[model samples]
Target chain A: MTTFAPGRKASSSRRHPRRGEELTFWIFLAPFFVGLLIFTLLPIAWSAVLSLFDAQATVYPTIFVGLRNYIDIVTDPDFLNSIGTFLVFTVFIVPVTLVCSLGLALLVNRLPHGAGFFRTVIFLPTACSYVVASLIWKLGLFNGLESSLANQVLALFGQQPIYSWLNQFPLFWILLVTVRLWLQIGFYMLLFSAALQRVPEQLYEAASIDGVRSSWRMFWSITWPQLRSTTSAVILLLMIAAFQAFDEFYNLVGAGPTARPPLVYLYNRAFTQQDFGHGSAGALVLTLIMVVVALLQNRFFGFGAADDDSPRKRASRKKVAA
Target chain B: MPGIGSTQISRRQMAGILGLGAVTPLVLAACSGPGASTGGGGSHPTLSQWYHQYGEAGTEQAAKKYAASYKDATVNVNWVAGDYASKLNTRLLAGSGVDVFENNAINIADARAGKYADMTSIIEPIKDQFSETALYNVQIDGKYWGIPMIIDPQAFYYNKAMFSDAGLEVPTTMEAFYECVAKLSSGGKKGIFLSNTDGGAGFSSTMAWATGTDIIASDNKTNGFSGDVDALAETYSWFRKIQQNGFGLQGQPSDWWDITPFANRKIGIQWGGMWSMPQAVKALGDDVGMFPMPPSGSNGTYALIGSNWNQQVAQKSPNRKAALEFAKWLWVDQKQDQEDWALSYGFHIPPLKAVAASASKLQSGAAKEFVDAFTKYGKATGPYYTNEIGQAMEDAGTNIIVKGADAKTQLAAAAKKIDASLATLQ
Candidate 1:
């Protein structure tokens, strides 16, 4: 059963074990790297090349345009407006999602029983496909048909239900925010709940001794500061999710100028119009913006970077261990 | 996309398998190529055919049956459901097993890129038998790129009983149509459904035609919207009001393509196509009726528009000659299959004039009315009106009506963008 393969352990005990472990580690990692190379890395590099061409109706680049696609996508008003939509969406969604999920986490955490039940109930929407959820929201709930559940509620109050929900400006935003929140709040709430459980019980006892008796005061003085890392992570995730939002805007609103985001705009430009050149350029630009935003977020929050790294704290920890 | 199952051969064998994630499936399906082309390069060559999922029952079966009957090759049919154009375009670009497929029309740009085989030779001899509108959809630069399969005309399909109950007449003008919507909407019943969202893309595209102007200018120079901007705006303003006020059905459980909302009496009028006729008649009996998109004024014109699905073979298909022969046989040579396609599953008009003329199911009642309307007012967007141009128009319509942007400003912006798009074509 002796083997010559680099990753395999030698049958002779005299052979070095370290080489086999190192080789085995690489062998196990090869599939993921291969997948990354083939699926992700190749397409991205190709997409970069595609951005500089006048390619249309085909994947392979034909005529070299040399940043013409970039110029067109940048100068385009619809694309600019989509960025504005992204900003507005992020501004509305991020803070609202954080507050709602945190509030729900607190309420669920305080429950004497059924915390697991409430958690499951809240988390179920996250399991459903975004496409399926968006379809249900558009076609079933907000379809604006007189017999639709939304309109039927209005009927119960003897009021006429006649508004075209998806087309209206404020209503469109309201419905979008609501559906997205419903789909994501449970998952974020669970994150908060997990962080909440990790907060030391001694902190609450110490806070009570300090005259911070009110629950709101106790949370603000102690719990809120303790959950800063989780909050920063949540905010970062939420911002990325907001930028990537496409299913609801597309399926519910049907690619109208009123609701289109960058992804939807890029999809239409590339797939719908068969203009791969511009689509690739537009995608790279959006990716650039996302990277900038993430960098800015890291600078502003300093969440993981600033935690307990002071020289005094390091010395104190060493003293305690000694 | 739809899994091409329920085939008479073996449902499990002809697998149009969907992969993980919604968007990922489109890429996976396209990248994987055609299904079950076993025995390729042998004496028995196989041709791969694809189709968008038709809402009509038995259409998939009919497609598979047509493929099975072709003894020259083992034809594998893939029935794609949503967003078929993207999937088809990606597949054609991959130069995989895509031998032949159906689409609204063969994209001239794609053909110019050498993706589509010129169908002029296949269609030339039988040109006289095809409908003019059908030919216009698949023809470009004086060369045929696709063979017309079916002419699906979309128009107003109203509930006869509901209209009568509301003491209304079939609207013949834009004003009367507005009045009908307002009056018919009461007691939990909606007036109309022009798709479930964006107030209907079909309605927006045909609005200019309804106002006595074609979608394109003379010699395919530019869009005709620049000719009559005010008429476009005023009509759109009215549409906005109808949509905003809830006279029209917006958020229906089903799309305007389905007549279920109409049949269930939730809507008095529905903007539907000829394909929904059989189900409408079966459910509502004598309750269904047909009409055109009403003219804007005394000076305006009646109009209707639909995507004419055309069949085309790929230049880089696995077996191009066999693929061409199969397309020619099923779409042109087999008169019985053509007639059955036109009449059996749904009420689509066969491209062949001979088949359309003999379709008995379309000779009387609801089907006849649909045919009459189509014959009189059927309109097709010019080849110049590509997706970019069409999207420019749609964006203008959406901005004006939904976002409440000034119509003149929106139209001007649209005009500028469309001019740029048209510039690319030349």
Candidate 2:
């Protein structure tokens, strides 16, 4: 009988990976590390270098102008408008998406059968590309009062079609918000659904026997407290996504006259207008703002957090389960 | 569904994983060398040529035929359909753009950066073969940047049926044109379908052509566009008058109106371009006819004729000989292509005088009349027409038409910018 002791030569031999194992680990990690450096770190470094120059299109030679590009970006009215648009988008979309997703998860959880099928149906929109969705919304679903499906239904009731819904102010924001909600609610619902399943079934049964008959009472006492971590994570993810609303606006309204998100505007300044320096400066400012928002959300909400788990919390959870 | 025996990913781990997966390859590719457009049979020294979506299948066929005729050379033509400038600029910046490509005057300033080759010798010999106005567009700062391939003059098109219904003859003068507008609008029909958004700038182009305006008089460094301002104000006054008279800014606006409304018989006359006629022929089905805008005061100033795409070689091209060879062949050797492009979709007037007279089929009688009018009475813009000053004036003029911004205010602002831009040019 071979007993493997902790420090025994045979046990140590079994514990340490062979040279082949070490090589295999690096081989597996090589692809991912290379990708990170190329796509994220390198472009970031290049952009930082570009931000100081006056990089016009192939015409004017690019010259390093120190913080002039940054000054221009901060002072530009167009930049301010983009920030305002992003704030409005974030303020409305984050809470709305969260509540709707939570509500949907609870609804589907109560369903007696075919929960998996319903979950798939709800989550389907998230899988579709933003460009595809925006196109459908632009040409087919919200084209105009006369041609759109929504307007056609509205017309049946003798009401004017909501033509130019995206053209008008505030309404355009609401429309964008609605489209985003349609896309993301399903994914978050699935997340909360899984979290709800993890919540011990016995506690809910006890609460029921104790005459906690009201749905709100049950949710407040049981579901809400349990979903705190998940809700925090989902909200934080949503806030980050909202800041990067370029694909939707870029496809729909284009960078023509009206629809100019910060990223789109940055792209236009850098590429279209051939002002690479300005474009780089704009990109950095936008990056800083987004990173700050993400950090703040992470700190306050404890979303995407590794420190969420602790011995005390684990003990309490086990006791609650028991 | 997410937590069902699934592992939780740490943020740092996720970042490291994604960074390795996504960023590394792209950075490496950028750092290496220019990515070529096509890899094919190496029987010939293949050069990549970029074109726009404007020309249809006939243009492509013509280009291919030209490439096939070349000995020890093959040209691979890439057609860009949308977001062209952005893509081209990206390739240019990355040091990986095509050998020869077509771009418009609007983007010429950028194309002339240290990236494009000076084609003074190649273009100088062929310059006299082109309309003086067409030749002017290819030159930037006393150097030939490109070879002009086609001339597209913005013109006016009217439905023959709509005109007959209104019992109106085609207007012969600017005054007569406005009178026709009044007659057309009285019977619940729009006089024009102009979108203020695009029309403001578009209208300014032809207006400058008609007014004989020397938009900018540049003597090396000192820039002048005071004359352009006077002409712009006069042109905006005309458009404002038309709008205020209950034309009702309705339907798809701007120059795109040459077909949409005219096809539906919703409007009698549309201010558009020679390129617009073919689409009109398709939509209205053989009843379409066009004429140059009536003279402002009968001094022979009519429509502003200009070229759309010009071909230039990259100065930084390691294969300079290959790039210029490809460019010269694209514009000159492809004479059949030049003719076919000139004739395609009724949109082009060939830069080659021979193609216009021989190969192009301008069947409409009104078109023939305008052809004669150009031969006898047309006035091409001067060399100053293609300068930084001209562009600034155009920008100023466009703002007035679109925004109804005070022409004097906008024009003056345009002058200052023009002056600043000119100072840098020298």
Candidate 3:
């Protein structure tokens, strides 16, 4: 074993000079820092300031009403309804997406041939623009006319024609969930497939040698435990994506009252009603909810935790040796 | 390794390249401004005229042609494609290069906030030549803020062959209208097509007028539908029946704005605007006939008459005078252009009374019937009927008609919301 004298090595390297290394470090970081300041930080600060004012008529706020906008948004029935609608959408879509994507990934991973073609075909819908996909679903497939594809298939089965899938209650939810599933399933499936590929062949072989004859037992013992990190990441991403759903809902249902999500509600308040202050407050509240949820998820999953054999743990172990 | 002098020279060149890269975007951004010129090359003050994209063919070319013909100023017509209202509002707030633009309804708050210029001086001289309803919403605080461009009167257009086959005459009462719908809906054909997306929002104005209720009070502060809740509820129940009985086309390929369903014989009757006359004529020939929404209560038959487009000069425009003069020259002084704009491309009634009367298109067939119906029963909305109030009513209508909510409860809720909005206006 080689001994690591990390303190002496650090002291020697700090005492020495490298030509142009410091300049290169800053040169690479400058662009990213500039962009962060300009695009992300500035807008966040400005929106925070705007949330404290009353800007109903003009672009700039003329009256300062501290926390009143926030109070109003929390009390507003339409805003609350939008939140309820989004939560319902999330509860339905997140688990369905997880199960469907995982199933697809497992099926594809088990295939020995034509796997690439299957993956590509399944992934094709992800490449389509949300607006174009929504229009195709609305005008071509679910159009309530007797000649639409859905109705035509139903007609063959002797089923009566049902009109206005978007206006109907549970069917509207199904429509939204189906379109979103078609768009997002391929990406999550690819993630799970990559994670599945990383599991060692020896783990499955060892479990089988120990009399684990069933595939279910092998998966539970050898496959699932190995995919903990990826599963956590996938669930977190799906939750966040479910919260920020705007394009599909906007293009499908439009600004109708029945299916208004929070983002659409905020958009109408800001652009349609010209109430920027309340809209900004609503955005801030949504951001806070997202951050809290992310924090709770991180707390439960312990994402980015250093493994015993990781480089970070190794470096700390060497420091302890010093 | 390179020599010191050569290395220094290379470093200087590198610095110069990076500097250029950093400054290029700034220079380009400075060169590019909002509402940058798309067409006009003249030295005259180019007055930018913005218009929402008209679906009718040749409307854009006609607008540009009219602009090019104006000798007083170089007019650059900007045909905004999608979400014209939102874009226009944003630009107005930015106080950009919009010298003039078109909107169907002028928001009084925007006008009061000084976003639009007063066109009273130009409109007052020939105001009498325009119909009273044409100038109704344009005048704010007894001053005209916009020039009326064209009038689109919406009425019922029925398939003549289908009506005759059903052995039905034109409906003169609400009960008879339902009976006619049921008769026409036989054999897989929908009886009527209102709007696919928002249920019956397109026909709510006409329905209210037919029921002898002004949705908005003349005082512009109180709700008018509250006075006759039973009658209004009855009308909404009719809409619900149309949907529940499948008498109305629910999800067609196109919205009610297009005459495709009517033209394709998928729907027997359509509550469509006069703008679809050309398309209907092209598809159905003489099989189309038009009539106003018949009397529901003691009210007489009525058609919804509203401005198709109104031209208004921006308040912050540098060339306000030039813009106003061009608007007057196009919409008011040049009577032939008004007639051409109304009849040539899409068949709208000219806002100017004489121009509409003189147009040969308005003299015969279904077009003549539409004109007659409009003349006898065109009911205009109040000046205070803003988009917010309109949206509230539309939501209530959707609730009552599509969702089968309690009509009285929804209307009461809508009235409360509308009163709150009006209070803000006050």
Candidate 4:
């Protein structure tokens, strides 16, 4: 019998390990790839194809009208108006969410006690479905009935009842903004809190020793700068979410000329009007807008860059330079 | 010294968790797909019937009971809830499962696209049983595509107690109606509640009819409201004036479909349907009365009448013959079930004249008055009155009545849009 060394088996296994490892890696990745291909990639491809046809109520399009659908949507007054409405909504909602969520995160982060309790309390609304939250806001609070909570509060201040806040333009923005802030601010606050924790304590101590007595100054110098990446992410997400606003508008404001958003307009065009070609074209146009905005934001903020260069890394680099 | 934290999970474990997370939904979907079919595994052919979820109790159970009684094929009743029209349209396009369905109005475009089957042979014998107007809606190119289910007559329901207490006679003219509204707006009660916010949505058709003008012309090609645009504008101006003067409720807690405002004495009058008669009777007992839209200029008062539901067979159903047999048997042959469907849960006029004549609820006081109004002043919605056209009219009316936009301009713009949409249908 030939003598066998104990380490030879290990060496032989290492030499041929990559094939099995590769197979296992693919096995783990297959489900996700398959799902993404079937649900996301296929629908996107089909929508792009659909945008070129004059498909009405039917599944198959007999007439291929190239660029006409796009031209019609661009010139369509209603589609343009819907885009304007969404922009107005985003302009107001995004900054308000950023400020409010940051303020909340700062306040919660500074608490010596009951921080967890307050964080959970603030984050509770995020768990609620948008539809349910919208209905509660619409029917329970701003129902336009004299007996509603909002009107009751108004009555306490010796003001007359204001019915149907949704019907009132510009004033209804307050309602939409309030509900969105209530639902979304919590998650963003958590994100800010996590980023705040990763901020080095030594920097704050050093700043305090350098005679920086004001908390505002310290925050502006340290905390805000430390949260640059998180803030950029929050803003990008908020803009995308604001652009895709449909549920709250659909549930609260309903279909009317008053507050028709782009998605709702697209829905009416596709399903209600049975003009699939126009709907698909509108969707592609919306997607293009979102992509352009995201690219612009990335260009300004450099979000795609790896944010691994900490103070230590910079100091080591400075030492090398010296 | 520790290298990595002991609490950290291994890469293999992480991969396993992520893989499970992604695979779970797909596996669940695969497992649940076949179980979703309501048809049991048997030799008998199973037919799927769809109905929009009705608000009234016992409607679903009644549908199930009716389906259970059909022995020719196993009938699976699918009570669809929320956005039924869109869902039905999608399923019909997919061309699967749906053997029969209930539609409020048949789309002529869908009919031309071969979405619905021709039911003329089944209805030709009993076609005389249904009213002429009911038959008129389903007839496309001299062929019936659907069978009428129920007739819902919409009119204004007034509180008799409030009217009598105010010593107000039922107003028969537009001017008299305005005076009645003004008189009723006292003692913490408003004169009328048209709808929650649209300020009388469906009533525009009634108003046009009352003005002796058709909203959609007989030819279904041109705008009918254009015939007497000035008169229609004047009528809308009167609505705006009433709204401005606070004679009508500006914003109520309930919508136009709800009879609660009139029942609870919150408003003197409300635009409601015959479907809510049971709720009105339960709340106001003998204190309720019905009236049509008061005559505007020289036309007689008009009651808005439309089909509540119509049974249709999907043209793509594999078992179309069996499905048709089930539909005719249930909707046509069984008159008792039809009456039950109309009168038992919530009040609706049976489409069959013979069944309607024998309905006990239709022979009495308030119900009888409603029936009489429906018979005398009833105006059926034209076959060409589609959801798109309805939406245009609503928008124009809202602009005129609520926002006080120029009525002639708004109506003209609306007519233009309607003509364009109707052209597409042609």
Candidate 5:
């Protein structure tokens, strides 16, 4: 203001010119930070404390139980069984989602037109609430009624309706898997499609010139390498989601002993039984396992890295190592 | 991204003040309730009441109608939906907003947490008016915690036409009942529908009790399967036989509580409630008949479960006296509302002795039959038997009946789990 530089921009001439912008930025973001602190961070911190107390029906605790809650949850056979359920879900959903989503992406990319329409159609299911979808699955589609879509398939083969596919053992898994796949596959497919679109065509042309005639070979040599990071992310997300599955399982099957995942188990323990102490402990255990899993994923896939680990970067890293 | 601060200050400041001024009155007023007293000035207190969304139509309006009749306070009836138990319990624990609520079961843990007010004082005066049996469910540790509203007995409502077509009598024994079911199931028609998902969930304690085993023994702490373990196993085995052979409606659209499955002709025999009889009779005409969960042997142990819903006031209510007074006025003092609530909307037995005696709808036909069976065999678990225990019982029953698990093993494990749950209460 006293003597403005002639060559420089007005903002650049002053030291720390963004001080006003910074304050304004904070003013805009302050409400969100306050909300996050109150809602999420505070509750998480409180849960950690609640896990150490003899919190029964009330969240407010009077007695300190130390590691007793943890001991009880760990030794509890039901908690262990829930882990098995989570593992079974992870095994079913992860790789299958990865392959199926990738396949859909490739097929849609090859389409001459209407790619957006197809993508929108597939992604629409992702917008559906889990509770609504679960009720429909439980009462409408997979319900044991003769008019149900599941029984209609059996009817097509000139057979009577199958028994409640929900309560039965092996058949129950089919309902769980199919409903989950239908809900999530479309969204993952979009992610893959976006990644596929970003992929460079030069690699494919090089592969073709190198006498790689088969599409399968080209995919393995070029498309496969390009899509590795996206595949890892999808796998990581699917695994995390499988662990967090509560709304669908709780709504559809309820707290079925053999079918309950860890979150559902924790919910029953916390909310149903009103043993918030044990439930909090079980929840922390699940959170720890998930954190460990995410860390492992980061180690294996270089996920969540600041810079993108694109194929060219990996090749450059290999060159540097050489 | 330009801030309002980039503009002149006077207009923005004035706008801010105007906005706050406009919102202040709106924020302060919460008296626009469904059944708020019109004549009462702003000096009167407002009491918040809660009720789970009842399946029957006009229930919410009837509740609000009853609330509107109360001139003492502005009573707001919050018709809660989806997981009402959890919401009510959480609110009660938080010691805010909730004043009065309706619930069928009270967990001992909640009782310890001071979620429920001790209604012994209110109920002690009118103790003789309520049905003696209905009093047992809400009584905890020799104290009444809730005011009984409706005595809902869940029984099997069957198509009388199908019964006559198959020449079947209402079986007195479980074995005979199985035979009747097998005979009725033919030509793609199902014999029974338990709303298999949760059908017979409440009767878990009854299963043990059927074999002279109390789920909670007289000692009040231990599971009571030690005496008749083998008998309980046989009962489970017989149920497995019934569930597998008969074209049992596995997973109907509606559960045992709802009348739709039985009324829709989906099953010949449906494990439905007495409230469903009017609808069933209307749908299936005079062709509907009723029976209890039949006795296994001559031991006189029929698993005729008598469950009820009750109105309770919160201990931490801001105006506890007013809330309790309103609850008493509606459920206890007002006999007409209780009678109307029970009989008009759905066929439930009036918990009040005077109302039940005077209500002519329950005197004859299927309603009379239901009353007679309930009188003879209707037994309820004590207040100590929480929903969690019931759930574990259902899980164990599912294992034995559907999954083909060994009953002895499953029963033992369930008993152990139940005992552990009881132990935590101590």
Candidate 6:
């Protein structure tokens, strides 16, 4: 009845466009939000709530025990022992892994030919699944003290090979550290290699012209300055990874008296003993330790030459000065 | 040139190429889930089974046979290759574990907290089929919490070649056992292969049973031997004697220690369970032979027998009755199938007396010697020691024998710890 102009129709089409945009926005975001809510967010929320109560393996009604789990775990000798074991593991693994991977990177960096092949070879262990590597170590190769490859190597000498390398203290510790070092070297090596490549050729050439013949001087003056961020990153990553060494110990060392990592100890408490509250408390403590360690490592060991203050740190100061 | 390029890039062409790459990753991840295999997951009822895949033929055959028989219900058997208890507990707590499984009694009793169905009524009708010990081992608090699927009775496997070479008879008395062990050792073959791993539960269980003082408490309602420290001390002293003699395997990783010396023909006497027999046969073939472990005093040969394989319906299972009915069919109706499965490998002993009788003839010669060890001298006890008491026995058994830990002090401490643990169970 009313004369509807063509321009009016076009203008009307633009009406309620905000609603259409909102619909499209939600449509695009729906899948991710649903998955996040279902998988990550819900479980995290449940774990936090459950951490406050006495939850057994079965879905029996939980009792609000009021921080009793945290207290018990702190006091328990077994949990304390596990903490000691984790400390030992970190002390042994962190420095060893960092040094070995760096050394391996440097070693391969000098290779004139087949550098890619050597890199691939070093990285091969990383590509093999942890579960598979653990099984291979447990069976076929290790076998027993008398027959294990290590024992056989010992047998070549005049020593009578002991039956159980895993039972003895320092030997067991060494074996575990070695296996871990083997598995982690490739991962850290790849990181160092990438960082080493990014290091400008000009820095090394400048150092070389200054008659810095020592490899040590070159590393400190040239290589290290460039790798500051990367090294800090690698250290933080390796520390976290070392603390999370569960699968290898779980599969290889087993739940025997000799070998139980902190994660394994926590797991045994939660599932084996059905003491979930205590287990969650242990996990929380572990998380706190990890966070603190990471922050400290970054703050102190972060890339630097002590000679001059970085402009970045000074800029924050300059803002306050202004 | 621009016109031609625009014409070539048709709407459908652009959409098709873009869509293919985007969808490929999603498709790949979907295919990576358990259901990707033709064997796993569907609308069909999946009967989840937990099994240890230590040996090749023993485990794989069982899986194939179970899958073949149960066409209507899909048998989803997850064979764990690591520490059986740890993995089983993880899956159970995750609330997505096997519907039916097997483990040692101590592990099962602990698992009864929430993971299993109250199978007291289910096992009532079929109670007479098993021996009293078998029945008792599976019962927790008057309820049949687990079905005794396989009886793992520890025994002494002797390499007939080595025994004959040493010209020693299977020992009957403690003194005689020592003499034979010494002779076997002097002949260059190791005297005994004693696995002291898993807190040496295997060796300690056999020794505790032989001494007539239960290594673990026999009742879940109370502590070890009702606070009988004297009895616990006596048993500890006896183990110390065994440890001092040539009868100890140094504490090592269990599986490797159990198999290596026995397989290499370096040991004449290997103490292990029925599960080890098939492995021995596979490694040494017909050359291997087995007998009941030597008796400790007049207590006679104390063979440690416990339920290895058992299944329970999930209380939360939607098809609870159907799931239980499947278990019954697998265990009771197919008792012969179980016997045949065991006989095929030449080691496993069936729980059913009828099946045992039928298989007895097939298991003659050295096999008879091993079966006799279980049949004649075997004794099973329920509510076996858990936690501290169990740890105490292991400490006394291995530490005293191998590491020279004082028998008296360690044993006394063990008894006290066990008494405390039992109090909680009560």
Fraction of the true interface contacts (Cα pairs closer than 8 Å across chains) found in each model: 0.59, 0.09, 0.32, 0.22, 0.39, 0.15
Q: Which CAPRI quality tier does the interface of model 4 achieve?
A: incorrect
Residue pairs in clash, model 3:
none
Tell me the tens digit of each residue's lDDT in model 4 across A206-318.
Answer: 99999999999999999998998899899999989988998888877666656779998898888876778888999999999998987787666756555555444556789
Q: What TM-scores do the predictions have? A: 0.88, 0.77, 0.90, 0.88, 0.92, 0.77
Error of 5 at B276 (Å): 0.6
Q: What is the C-alpha local distance difference test score of each model?
A: 0.82, 0.67, 0.81, 0.81, 0.80, 0.64
Can you write out model 1's per-residue Cα lDDT over B112-195, one digit (the tens) per residue? 888888889999887998988889888888889888889988888888888888899999888898888888887655687876
The segments of candidate 2 whose C-alpha lies over 4 angstroms from its true place after superposition are A1-18, A58-62, A160-166, A170-175, A206-210, A307-322, B1-44, B55-57, B105-112, B163-261, B264-272, B285-307, B363-426
Give the per-residue lDDT of model 6 (tens digit) for B1-426: 223223244577569757966997898666442211132334566666666664635657666577568766766666777567667665555445456666664444354566666677768987887766677666766778766666666667778787787788766655676677777766323577665443244465565555555556544534443244444445445444544553444433455335556877767777666656656776788777766544564444455554455665554444455567677777777876777666665466777778877886436665666666666667765554553445545545555554556655656655665665556455
Q: Return the clash pairs for model 5, or none.
A: none
Give model 1's clash tally: 2
The RMSD of every model to the true structure, in order and in angstroms, is 8.4, 7.7, 4.5, 5.9, 3.6, 7.7
Give lDDT: candidate 1, residue A279.
Answer: 94
Candidate 6: tens digits of C-alpha lDDT, residues A190-268: 8999999899898888888888899998888888877777778887887788778887777766554455677877876
Judging by lDDT, tell me the better candidate of 5 and 6.
Answer: 5
For candidate 5, write residues B239-318 as lDDT tens digits: 68766664677766666688787788777887778988778878988888888766653353766677889999888877
Task: Judging by DockQ against the true structure, name the best candidate.
Answer: 5
Cα lDDT tens digits for candidate 2, A1-322: 9785667876776787566566556667876897799898997887888888766664334677899989989986557867776777788989999999999999899899988999999999999888888777766776542657767888899986653454344546655777888999999999999999999999889999998999889899998988888988887788778877888777655453344568877765776566677888899998898788767776666665665354446567899999
Candidate 4 TM-score, C-alpha based: 0.88
Predictions in order: chain A TM-score = 0.88, 0.86, 0.88, 0.89, 0.91, 0.83
Write candidate 5's Cα lDDT for A51-155 as tens digits: 999998878898999999999899987789899999998898887888898999999999999988998998899999888888888888988878899899999
lDDT, residue B411, candidate 4: 89
Model 6: docking quality category: incorrect
Which candidate should be chosen as best, given TM-score against the real structure?
A: 5
- Residue A164 in candidate 6, Cα distance off native in Å: 2.2
